[model samples]
Target: MDTNVITPEGYAELQQELDTLWRHERPEVTRKVQWAASLGDRSENADYQYNKKRLREIDRRVRFLRNRLSKLRVVEYNPVQEGKAYFGAWVTLVDEDDQTLTFRIVGPDEIYGKQHYVSVHAPVVKACLGKAEGDEVRVRTPDSVKLWEIAEIRYGLAAADR
Candidate 1:
């Protein structure tokens, strides 16, 4: 099962998408479908067929977003999480070669379509949890063990500075 937790910002983003699709795009597409259907002979009318298909897709996405929003639990940043890796943290890691990688640890649902956002369940994330800056994490990949050091950890609005 996908994790039910989401950062406050991630929750707002999902809510905004739902609002745009439902209140704006859905109405616009519905109008197109109605106008096309009025032309009659839907089987032969390309506009009608295409709009009908688009409407179904919109409806399916709306249903999913609504259900997901209802079930998600927003996780806000806490002062206690300072100086440690945790959910909603922006972590910068340095490998043995001094190659650096940066990403935010978020829920599985929130990671979709986002750049540099890793799922909380990801192996690298699991290995880094509770680790402080300068601590080494041995992440076990399918190929081999990779060592990474925590270069930095930032949370909440501080993360936006990057």
Candidate 2:
């Protein structure tokens, strides 16, 4: 498997999530599981079944987080990677239709449309790497390859100023 590269921001986010899962979520679910187990006939109890499934899910996530955290290498902010796109570059691109999309290239764990984070291994991010501003790149997808131009590329997390 390709080693996942994580930025400091991504690592911190994962730590926060792990902390929440362990300190808050786990305890709450454990209480529910206990309450469900106390009820008679666990095999037939709906609460027991639901809670058991939830506990299994939580445990799985916990294991994933632990393993991911252990393997990740947190990237520190460096000024040298400014001009060229790299794994943690925050890039802004414009599609053929002139639609603009802004995203940060991080690791797999940090990716989601809502988070504006794309995995470094993603096709689009991979295409954008080493590409400077005003460069046109063809991003290959399972459906069809789309063309996009690098309108802008900026680093630093959070807002542009931050």
Candidate 3:
């Protein structure tokens, strides 16, 4: 399997989520399932059915968290490597049209709920990696090639690492 690299903060966030799911959410769902089971016949009990399905979903997520945590390696800031972009770099880019966008390079699981976050495995991140501030990069899509200028770069904290 390919090794996954994540910032320290991202790792911590994943661990925190895992803890919440296993310690809190899982037990709560289990209890609901048991309570629903006590209400009526198994085939027709809606509560039991809902809670059972919820438990299965929770178990699946928990297992994914456990497996991912085991496989991912957290990348910590070294200060000396801050000038150019890497896994944790917060970069701002301006398109040829002068429209600017900012994003932090993160792992796949951390990509949700953030307007400016990009997965390290994404095409934009791959194009931005190893680039320094003021550098220019071109990203090719199936439709067209977008040319972007690196307006700024900062090795900012990953949410879990901070």
Stretches of candidate 2 off by over 4 Å are: 95-97, 113-115, 140-147, 158-162
By lDDT rank, best first, the candidates go 1, 3, 2
lDDT of 1 by residue, 1-162 (tens): 348999888898899999999999999999999999999888999998998899899899999999999999998899999999999999999999999999999998888787889999999999999999999999998999999999999986443434
> Which ranges of candidate 1 are over 4 A from the true structure?
157-162
Rank order (by TM-score, best first): 1, 3, 2
Alpha-carbon TM-score of each model against the true structure: 0.94, 0.80, 0.88
TM-score, candidate 1, is: 0.94
**What local lDDT does model 1 show for residue 69?**
92
Lowest lDDT block of 10, candidate 1: 153-162
Candidate 3 Cα errors over 4 Å, as ranges: 1-3, 158-162
Q: Ten residues in a row with the worst lDDT in model 2?
A: 107-116
Candidates 1 and 3, the one with greater TM-score: 1
Deviation from native of the Cα of residue 106 in model 1, angstroms:
0.4
* Residue 75 of model 1, lDDT score: 89
